[model samples]
Target: MAFEQPLDRTAPSISEAIDHERGRQESTLGMIASENHVSESVLEAQGSVLTNKYAEGYPGGRYYGGCQHVDTVEELAIEHAKDLFGMDHANVQPHSGTQANMGVYFSVLEPGDRILSLSLSHGGHLSHGHDVNFSGQLYDVEQYEVDPETGYIDYDAVASHALEVDPDIVVSGSSAYPREFDYERINEIADDVDAYHLADIAHVTGLIAAGVHASPAEHADFVTGSTHKTIRAGRGGFIMCDTEHADDIDSAIFPGAQGGPLMHNVAGKAVGFAEAQTSEFESYAEQVVANATRLAERFTERGLALVSGGTDKHLLLVDLRDSHPGLTGKQAEAALNDVGIIVNKNTVPGETRSPMVTSGIRVGTPALTTRSFEEAEMGIVADLIVDVLDTPDDDAVHDRVTSTVDDLCEEFPIYE
Candidate 1:
């Protein structure tokens, strides 16, 4: 069947915007730590006819009719997730990582339950416990910070804080942190305090699945992650837990949080998850970390101060305060954006700048590694970023870097 629609006529503006966005992606670098490009097959699956289906419940036991095919898709996604992450059960219905977190919270905690998580300025996420987010508003929250000198999460400090707060749940994992969480230690702390450990591995879902990073499935009571970020799967969320909590987690997503599942995205997840299980994917994951390490080395040689001094994963957080004094993260982001080298301004440990204008920038290698960039290319890219940061106001520098960025984008085309 010819499934193409007359999008040009029906929605010209939207179509044009999409075209421009595609052009933007094809031309610019996507260095945002949380973002990665999906495969063409995943794209096709996400745009399939399954989008029209409701599929309000889990596989087979749906509330709507005509769900047999979607049932198969969801089951494949769940099975693939379980196999990849080594979890007893997987729930793929949550619309986003945050929604997945909501399902977990709804499943176990009541209103005003205490949540102990890392501080946002110290590399945590809003969903973990920021005042503006629902989790913070709904729960009594206490936050721990990375050690100022070492720029790493101090597990001992976390233990002390957990003991003092007596949290109902202890959240591990981070969004912009360069180092890894000691999942075992955090889990032990939670166990000692009789608190549930929720490890939100949204950013490192791919790395964990590839076995390049540690998996929290064996340590945490609940594991939540986005299917896209490093995993390069569908643009949705998932939850993994023991068989004991599977039913509650599933029900929480169905009736407690979101209404209907996005079955097309589920199809995307199935395809991407299948893609992730390959030896090629394992190589890709390894390259991601290698490229990041190269970036860290290059950035350091160029005099950029990394948050943790280095990364054990695919991202690095550059603190502009020491390296480029008086230059705000917003300024650095604008400088890089002007030259087509994409990155995000972030809050570092000991951050004093407002959230709108942070003190640091986060750079990641997943998208570039997906483009088949190795250490050499990554080193070059790192130099380009540092050059922009070094001379934000120099037009000659901007023009030169822009040419190199265009060349890199052309050489490493995303879809082509």
Candidate 2:
């Protein structure tokens, strides 16, 4: 395949842009739960000649000409994804998780159909049913929330709500809650309500593939996930389902939702899927959990209040109510960013503050774990975080934390 090379003097150099991005990653500690650094092979595939193709449709059925190579790439991506998740069929074309959800909704629901899902404030994605999203605007969205006291999903409550709502679909999975989901139980609830079960494993796809987390493919009727999060691929989305819904799902993603697929990203997804099939990827997934646990423990020991008391996956939600009294999540996020620790402010369950100024921060170990940081290093990171939070005004402490973070990051360099 002949790829178009950028004219050297036509624009800001692509090499310069790449170098700047690499510098940003090298200098900062990325602690966002929904982010990760993809492998070089994935990057190469994402930057390949496949990007120039205009394959408006699926393999062997393009709406445009010259799609032979892209067809091969997309087919590899779909097959590998199906094998990885043990799904009967796969759709590797959604532009994002939101789009993936939108396609699913289009496939199985009408404009005014009642859809039940987890509450956004209680760890659900925006596409699941946030009032501002298309899902909420088009459908009658009823939300199910976690128990405030236990910080876990109340299945009994969820069942009752499903029964009352009589939804057309019941969506499981979360963006923040730290625990394993009982997919079987949730599926049973959906079955009793005569609703389809859709599991969004966007945050835990890597763990699920590594055998560290439960696979929802066998239990849920449909599953959607992002390739960039735990999967460590380029930014994109995928959908999987049983054979019965395969044709409908594929049609929904194509003609029903998006037009031409980004063949470059599809190629990257194929590379990522191949990488995940290896033993090393399994080890990486296990370390992601271990690093998160270590970080959580360190924060607890330092008197920081962690949501749900701790984490069972690669992420932690720290409630700053008690430790940093009067400090908002926005302030904390800014302060931490100043010290080279990148995390996002997030809402806690029943938060008093708005989404922009949350009362909590979400942190994750995936990127650090990708850099090969272990338990001991996580303890150091915990101490640095505590120091910064305790003395946000101290420039010296911030500088020290920055320097220490730089050094630690150097010890476990990425993309070298």
Candidate 3:
């Protein structure tokens, strides 16, 4: 039997928007650090009929019936996650990385528990304890900052701060940080402070899986991550622990944070983890880092000051202060958007501008790497981005860059 949908008959506008979004993806470069293109198989799994079922509880102990097949999906996802991260146990629920962090916090942290995390403008995630996020509102939050001169985490300073605050939990991870973290150092700091160490490896899941970067699973007490970023999985989150806290983690994700699991997404996670297990995925992950390195080199060669001087991962933060002093991140982001090169405005270390109008733009190479882009092509793309920033007011240059991007997209068709 074949499945077919007359989307135009039921929802023409929504279908059109979906198609248009696909077109946009195919035409434009997606430079967001936290985004990637899932495979067609993963997409199929995510859009499957499993969405109709509600799997509220764990496999073989669900509150609802008819979850036998979805149980297999979730179990496969869980098993793959354990193998992928080399963890003793895995929970493939939580809906997102934010919720995964929430699950870890709920499992161990009480309301108003002391928490120490990296500051937002310095590369930490909002869920880490931003004033607007639940983590902040519920916990007693303290933040650490990147070193102004180096644009990187100051481990010594972090240890000093950790000792001063004596937090119940110390969070290590970032949304826009490009360099690899010293997980061992952080673990030591947490141990010294007698705090739970939670590593949110949401941004570098693919690199860690590929062994291109260090794994936080072996060092942190709890590990939470998203499946969608560099992992090339569909949108979802997961938690990893040493099996001693498995029950509590599961309980936190289920009753404490999220309700029913999205079984279709579980299927997608299974499929994606299977993909990540292959040697091809390892090569892809390597290329992602190489491309990012190439992009950063080219950007620096173009006189754009890169945060931390360079990246050891698939993303980079470009500080436009010295290079394009008059141009705000918002302005640069808009100029890049006009030329079909997508990037996000982000706050740099010691930022004076607001978050919305940041002094930095964070660029990444994951989605492009998924589309089979390599270092040489990444060099060209970086030049195109710098060209747009250089002549933001020149329509002719924008037209040229736009056409070049179109050519590049044609050369690297996502579906083909």
Candidate 4:
């Protein structure tokens, strides 16, 4: 294998781009709600020689040769995931979170099965049932939205809609929602309609694992999550189900939805899951919520309207329609980027703008918290973000914010 060779010598372009990305991450403040920094141990495992192997089947059952070592890695990942999330079975082979959802859908659903999920504009994910995604193209999808006045999902409304639709499956999760979900209530609703409950905890997997946020494992029939975002695991996905559906879920992932598993990334997941069990990780998760709370408080005090008013987890959805009328989320994102702060524009409840140019920005604290940022630092970052949004055209403000961001980045280096 040429795996031991240096990338700079053989693929300079790719190596240069990788270097640039590291530099960018080290220099800027990453506030994107769905992003986080993984540990160096995870980085090493993901970049290991296992990437050169082909692990086409689950542990102790292989369709290919030389899978013995990789099988150990996969088994460790599976066991750790099962222990971490308290699920009876785990399939850590889905290439991404979307594929994880696809695997679960393929296992139990036929074409055109009805799906009831949260609306995309109101903080739901594309994989839940968006028209453009395969989930929607293959399923009959109906959406539920948050209350326009309170900016929170009304459980009564969800139950009413579920009764009317009688869906085959009820999805409980979101991408930009700022409040905790009532998973028990949703599971009960699914029961009333005789529908399966699938909980996609991709964005809050780490928080749930650390016990900072409530877990959906006991309430939902199926659970799916991303390995990278909040978990700092790696760049892959996993599915959790009861033993009754374990074999079905594994086969769905292997032959039904995907091919060979990314064994190296599975190794990363194994390493990250081990790290996440530490007491420090619990405190880190707690600080993440605290920082987000402080940031939301500062935003509200500065007159920025927050969807759901504040956050109960790691992220906030700021609806800019009232505070900065005529200014689009795209503009706010660019202005913040100019000041060395990174965030993504998102659609809020009752969104009127197109997906390309949304009316809100989704900010989070997991990445900053990984860098050891606390409530005081989050307050400062919030002020900087609001200042940029308040005066996007002020050159002096840009320069000042840029300098402060540089100073903060230097003080809290991501990789010592």
Which rank order by lDDT, best down to worst?
4, 3, 1, 2
Model 1 per-residue lDDT tens digits across residues 1-416: 23366888778899999999999988998899998999999999999888999988888788999888899899999999999999999999888999999999999999899999999999999999899999999999999999999999999999999999899999998899899899999999999999999999999999999999998989999999999999999899999999999999998998999899999999999999999999999999999999999999999999999987999999999999988988999999999999998899999888889988999999999999988889999889898898888889999999999999899999999988
Across 144-205, the per-residue lDDT of candidate 4 in tens digits comes to 99999999899999999999989999999999999999999999999999999999999999
**lDDT for every model?**
0.93, 0.90, 0.93, 0.94
lDDT of 2 by residue, 1-416 (tens): 12345543444587678778889889899999999999999989998888888899889888898888888888999888988899999999998888988888999999999889988888888999888999999999999988988788889999999999899999998899888889999999999989999999999999998999999988999999988999897688999998899889989999999898988998899999999999999999999999999999999999999878998898988889889878899999999999989999999887899999999999999999889898999999999999999998898998899999989878888877
- The C-alpha TM-scores of every prediction are 0.98, 0.97, 0.98, 0.99
Error of 1 at 26 (Å): 1.1
Error of 3 at 306 (Å): 0.6
Number of colliding residue pairs in each model: 0, 0, 0, 0
Model 3 C-alpha lDDT per residue in residues 1-416, reported as the tens digit of each score:
12365787577898899999999999999998888999999999999999899999999999998988999999999898889999999999879999999999999999999989999999999999998999999999999988999888999999999999899999999998888999989999999989999999999998999899999987999999999999988688999999799999999999889899888888898999989999999999999999999998999899999999999999999999999999999999999998898999999998999999999999999999999999889999999999889999998998999999999999999997
TM-score, predicted candidate 1 vs. hidden true structure: 0.98
Which segments of candidate 3 are over 4 A away from where they belong? 1-5
**Span of ten consecutive residues with least summed lDDT in model 2:** 1-10
Could you tell me which residue pairs clash in candidate 2? none
Candidate No. with top lDDT: 4
